[model samples]
Target: MSGRGRKIVWGLVLAFISFYAFLEHDVRGRFAARQSVEPAVIVPNKALAPVMAMGFHNLWADFSLLNAQVFFANPEYRGRIEKGMIFREMIELATTLDPSYKVAYFFGHFALSSYWNNWGVRQANEILKLGWKNNFDDYRFPQYIGFNYYLNSENKNEIVKWFRIALRYPEAPRRLIWTIDRMLRGADTTNHIHAESMCAMCEDAKEKEQKRYFCERCETYTALIALNDLRLAYLRDKGRPIGSLGDLTAAGYIDKIPVCPNGCNWLFTADGAITSSSLAESSTDVRGVP
Candidate 1:
């Protein structure tokens, strides 16, 4: 071809490339905006998911797991807890697609239970029950069920039932076994159970940093137990609840309000109950305490 003809062809090619790139960018931007405005929907029935995955079920499960993790980690989701959101559905779909995916079961229970309200606890229990049924040999599932029961339910009978199930598995952690024994004997408080679980998690930590972090959590929970005990004693003696940590200090409950090892302040609820910001499950309101 002649030089002018070649130059003209090259200019045409560049223009096409630029136009394609601009179109792609615009399409991506619009899609992202739509996603941001409209929250994710829950997956349909679990039975249909594997068929929809088209033989790449594990890959689809992994994608669902990733989406769940990101959704639970999002601050907006954490704050809102909106109904019909994909939080529970994604985890359920992931586990349904790959029942043997232990990480999905574990993370689903943890994230759901961390919501620390009745609805969240019920959802967490459902996930843990599925985990227990599917992964029977793995004691963590039943153990988490027992723990959630202890935390949220006043039904001692149900607590004992799940704890017995967990203890039947020899692979159950030593701390869990101990907690169960304590609960059975009426020697453990909720704080003690929380501390024991934290200590158990600390023992399982492979990294020095993780172990240290869990150890700190153990200390904080323990301290909160002591502070709560003091509050109870004050109520017994004065016939009224202590108003705040400052009240405890002024009344000689302690030299001062004990500092939380987690660096979050102990919060006083509307009922004058003391709780740490770090322990979401410890709220009296969520536990249905009068």
Candidate 2:
């Protein structure tokens, strides 16, 4: 409208046009650079993932698994991780995020089916094996492995081995309450199984505090196992049972005693066994909270 005002407006318009041009040029450069590069997974390493999560490891694991699920569900990306990175194997990043995550192993079949690819089947089994190893009582883990075998192999023994593991629990075909009841009755490895159950609860928990709580319960059972190992080692070396729990620390079997998450004391049985004082026949009660 006025001479000075008009000049200022014109100057601003020129500057805006120059900035747009620079931005367009930068975009083109990046597009060209990535044109030859294959898309890659943005996941972090399994061991270092806990550090990245900073205590919300289960949440991160859920995010990573969901990311992979969405990616694979895409019709364009289905059966392959990416076009450019054809040879790159998709590591199960979710498991790395929370190795104790129970369902991530079961979901391996999403890729394991013949529709995904041959490699998908193999990779799925690899993921399932981790689950099976950590969760021996879970029928689904071994059952999934058996399904994978049916997909790729005619090995009946391998198939039976997994199926037998699955059938060990009569409650496998029933509701979860039944399974939990049977486990509580007298399963020899009840503590380990309960620890896995806690991990499963952590996997499905909606809140951060709840997830962390279940995970801590799982860790208590893990500590029980470690402390027992120390007890056995002390017995072997000293040629007698430990008079007390402190002998393991004094003998350098462990740097110190593991604290129970329930704020209870760790017990040293007369037979040189360790257990949490909170639960009955054993101390590895992973089901309760403070």
In lDDT terms, which candidate is top? Answer: 1
lDDT string for model 1 (147-207, tens) is 7776676565567567656655656565664465444334343666656655665666555
**Mind giving the per-residue lDDT tens digits that candidate 2 earns over 126-152?**
778887787766778876776676566
Against the true structure, whose TM-score is highest?
Answer: 1
Clashes of 1: 0
**How close is every model to the real structure, measured as TM-score?**
0.51, 0.44
Residue 72 in model 2: shift from native, Å? 0.8
TM-score for candidate 2, residues paired by index = 0.44
